[model samples]
Target: RKPGFTLGAGILPFTHADYIGEVRESGLSYLSAIKNATQYRQISDDITLNAYAAYIFGLIDLAFPDGRPVGFWFNQIKQALYLIDSGLDPQIIANVIEVQMLKEYGVEPNWRGCVIDGRADLPLDFSESYGGLLCQNHWDKDPHRLHASPRAIFYLRRFSTLDLNKVERINVKLDTKAELRRILDVIYTDMVGVTPKAKRFLDQMHQWQDRLPDDSE
Candidate 1:
């Protein structure tokens, strides 16, 4: 359904080569020389999609005013893979990545006050509709505000400038993590407008993963 230059240079940049081999049966392996690279074997669909998340992000970066940096894009890809390799949930990793990028590339949400008015003393509510966060008074005025946990907000602030090493150090409660995950899903869906294929895939994977007796993905 597409034409030449389909998925051009960096577009849909494949995170793994096996996916290509499996899809096209070309008998060519990117890792042919290093036949024993265990890191590339037995990857999960959720993980692959998580890695592909970077490509989606890269596409978004195309609109960056400064013209996206190649190193920045590569670093984001590495961050996603690193979190996955560290045994972190691909979903959470994606959220953290988005939170960080939302600040760096996207609008740094006014976590300090209301998007409509600068009321810096009240609690915050994340509003995807207007972007960034909301205040208690504003939250009262609008019913569509996404849930925002203080801890989640706290960690998101840190994620804006913190490396994965520092990110790993934050002691987040499980419930707070879950809340952050949901909040980010809403934020990303609204930010992108119409859920992205990568996100839809992640949601589908979550449905199945949550069904297991010991589900923990």
Candidate 2:
């Protein structure tokens, strides 16, 4: 009944090939080559949205900010593929790549989530362990305020019990605050964080505690 809308919708699948072919045929153009090389299927919905956003927001040009023409966008694509080739989860690798692309291109992603209960997957034990490690390393004197540092300690603890050698290997690879944060965020959001209602109740308790006056006899 709705032939016009239906026709366009039906043609949507064909547009994939058209886009791929356009970039592939224009091999001489760096932008086109990057686009072609970065084209990926079988990505998760979230990753697909992120990649589409990057492409639309002039990621190719953004990668060359300061007029340096460094081809960092291509480099990110290469790195992501390398990780995938090395058996990393495609969605995780895609998220990492998207984050790197945003940073390189000077785009700040608007992160949204509940402050306390948002990350239930983050194991409390792991957070404590990571927090201890952070303290030992002098990364931060106070782990309570440093979100992921404590979580890194937790990772170290769990990995230590499972495979100490692999723990060391992974630790070596994780050299940045951003990487640490990402790992903790995933764990917290998926497994360790609490529910929103629990978080709210906790917050209310804290507020009640704050209102109480100190009594030193």
Candidate 3:
């Protein structure tokens, strides 16, 4: 999902009564709890996503199962501020924010780690940011090409602890007929410890293939 600001909304199955009872039972200060509940509702109204919306609605119902509807609303708002400040991604943030806004009645402005290595951390978020950054620098748009670039691989290898030997093994396993022969030749000459076993295996396989009946038709 993309990153941006918006109101909140939710889609869950819960009655106002269920929400109210939980509030009184929790023993929180009436004014503070009310504010939290309100914010939760507002944030729930603004954000968009099916799964989270349902969860927030369920949370609200559990929190205030018997209180007045207005009280439930206020409490949600207060909860939203806390959820938003907790570093949730945009889609989740939106659903959670609305639920909190409706329950609490206040808004909190705290969101971070939305970007990684100058790329948007979320799926679509990267499309815009990456595109803009690449265009500005006159770079290619294709991700495969970008990732294959030497500079890109260098940066990735610098940040990651990958196994080069394993990568070589995988490449050898998938090599074309000509490529496989070239790689096998190198292994026979340069590789140590496993060369004898590899050569024996290849020899046996080639002999087995030679014994198969020809199907020229």
- TM-scores of all predicted structures: 0.59, 0.29, 0.18
From the highest TM-score down, the ranking of the candidates is: 1, 2, 3
Model 1 RMSD in angstroms = 8.7
Quote the lDDT for 74 in model 3. 53
User: Once model 2 is optimally superposed onto the true structure by TM-score, how far is the C-alpha of residue 60 displaced, in angstroms?
Assistant: 7.4
Q: What is the C-alpha RMSD of each candidate to the true structure, in Å?
A: 8.7, 15.7, 23.3
**Over 4 Å off, model 3:** 1-48, 70-91, 94-217
Number of backbone collisions per candidate: 0, 19, 92
- Candidate 3 residue 183 Cα shift, in angstroms, is 48
Q: What does candidate 1's lDDT look like per residue over 78-148, in tens digits?
A: 55665565555555566666766664445566655578887756777777667766777778666887777
lDDT of 2 by residue, 115-206 (tens): 23334334332233332223233324344433444444444334322421121122234344345535534543443332222223333554
Q: Which ten residues in a row have the lowest lDDT in candidate 2?
A: 12-21
Candidate 2 Cα misplacement greater than 4 A, ranges: 1-39, 44-63, 71-73, 81-88, 94-134, 137-144, 149-217
Measured by TM-score, how close is model 1 to the native structure? 0.59
Sort all candidates by lDDT, best to worst: 1, 2, 3
Q: After superposition, how far is residue 183 of candidate 1 from its true place, in Å?
A: 1.8
